[model samples]
Target: MTALTKNNPFAASVYVYDEEEYARMQMLVTEDVTAGVALKGDEVVSVFAHQDGAHPGVAQSMLRQATALGGRRLDCFDTVLPKLYADAGFVPVARLTWNDDYAPDGWNYETYRRYNNGRPDVVFMAYDPSAVGSLYERGAGKYVTDYDDGIAKTQAYQAASVGN
Candidate 1:
């Protein structure tokens, strides 16, 4: 594990997973990884970061390092992210959709509502290390889907009474 620090000059800590951990997360996603960065409890499995004015390639290197480290697959989401992840050999698998109208239990209390208009809908994609060489491989797809904190972005507009 690299000791990423502020002085290190990277916007985010690029992670490299060990063999054991990689295996565990892969099972959750139904994929295999020879290696890759496991971020936020395998929830946001990103090999890239686009925050803080950083170049996109930093994320690219992290993805390559993950495959090199024994990651057989790359798990990712979002249209923008998938395109970049695809450039590194990943393919789209499924889409995770969210509906702002149907508020979940914790929905009334998080930053999630801020993204409501956009609704935080996401697309998930991956690459199998074994299929890295093939230009065409049989891949399955699904529209299957499954969020938050609250800082009051549009709270004032929300009314407690139906009559209001």
Candidate 2:
């Protein structure tokens, strides 16, 4: 529900959304989701953008600032957005379903993803706290790995670091 008019190292502008609007989007989709805008000083550097399509650019921009701000993880339905997150070096963790009766398909998961709408799919992705820098510096090894596989790869890396 937010839009980013500008974004850069120095400044950015982002449209803000209230809880009511947020709820409406969820109600229409009837899925678990969250989104917002980013700002640096008084400028709107980037808006979280839409979850529907072509979000790689926006997700990367959002990831840049979100990581800088110590963002833990983002939760959203399995949609184009998660792919953008994965492309940004984040990994998919687990898929979950909502128990509400109004939820279609009983919020059941499809293909290890809870957001697959049959027409279009959605997925949730998680990013490592340290993968915020330039992709090359961090190594695209992790980025290329699927969300599920990344968990094991990261664990191995952690173990190796500890062994050293």
Candidate 3:
């Protein structure tokens, strides 16, 4: 899993598993599984395809599995990730990207995205499923505010751009 996403700036942050879940998360995977979809609560933190000697669609397949497994939200940094998730019933909220003055963020070989600001973030896109209602419903769309959890917990917008 790390090998596929090593080029990502957030590679260090992708390790979102809590101690207990880390030991057992693999039990949830089956023989046919070939991709990695890291989750935090109901959100998917990371998705990586084992592109080394593997077939296409590994990442897409895992994303579908994530939704089926109850992922409610996720932040996608890959250029295509936004579109892929949009087609899967998710609604785009914030589209952030690093400024042109700075280099774009992405795997070394990837092309710079058209727009981005979500961190790791050369061009980040965050999505939430309509079923959960959107930030607009919660009155947060006005400012694209970070969640107000008030304590040691995950914030919606914070976790929405990157993993744990």
Candidate 4:
């Protein structure tokens, strides 16, 4: 039940590597804690999902969308959930001081970085479907169990389309 704001940035934007994914909408919002995704010039899709919503499916849904076109996309300015992202299908790209420069008006950068001695915490992750397998993929099931989303219907529709 938290409010979204620039200082409480809980969103992420990834740079898509594949041409196909780059053409698609580059943002996801599966929860209330997430902020609006800002599309930069090109190839860069930034989504802001606050850390508070990590336990829910906010980050997972966003990561799923980022890699939906085959996992050839990346750029996450994340300061949270490395293992969570790993289990969901993304690979760690780097761990470093947050390089995120985007902020909303009246946002204080100094206080934010002070959480880690004047450095914002962050880890970059990329989705590489070829390099890693998700937990659900290895679990016993024909499809990952996302009861809230109409995944079954979408799959059925695609399968039916292919048969035609």
Candidate achieving the largest lDDT: 3
User: Which structure is stronger by TM-score: 1 or 4?
Assistant: 1
lDDT for model 2, on a 0 to 1 scale? 0.39
Instruction: Give me candidate 3's TM-score against the actual structure.
Output: 0.51
lDDT of 3 by residue, 113-142 (tens): 332333323222234444232222211122
TM-score of 1: 0.42
- TM-score of each prediction: 0.42, 0.39, 0.51, 0.41
Worst 10 residues of 2 by lDDT: 4-13
Put the candidates in TM-score order, highest first. 3, 1, 4, 2
How would you encode candidate 4's per-residue C-alpha lDDT over 1-164 as one tens digit per residue? Answer: 12354344332223223445435654445545443232333222454455565445565555555555333323333334445556655554444443345433343456445344334334444444544444321111122222222233334433453466
Clash statistics: count for each candidate: 16, 14, 7, 11
Per-model CA lDDT versus the true structure: 0.40, 0.39, 0.45, 0.41
* lDDT over C-alpha atoms for residue 43 of model 3: 67
lDDT of 2 by residue, 1-164 (tens): 32222232111112234665444332111122233444332222223544454443455655655546544344334444455556555555443443233233323334324233322222334456445342321112323224445445444544554566
TM-score of 2: 0.39
The candidate, 2 or 4, that scores higher on TM-score is 4
Alpha-carbon runs more than 4 Å astray in model 1: 1-36, 39-56, 73-75, 101-117, 129-140, 145-164
- RMSD values for the candidates in order, in angstroms, are 15.5, 12.5, 8.1, 13.0
Better of 3 and 4 by TM-score: 3
Better of 2 and 4 by lDDT: 4
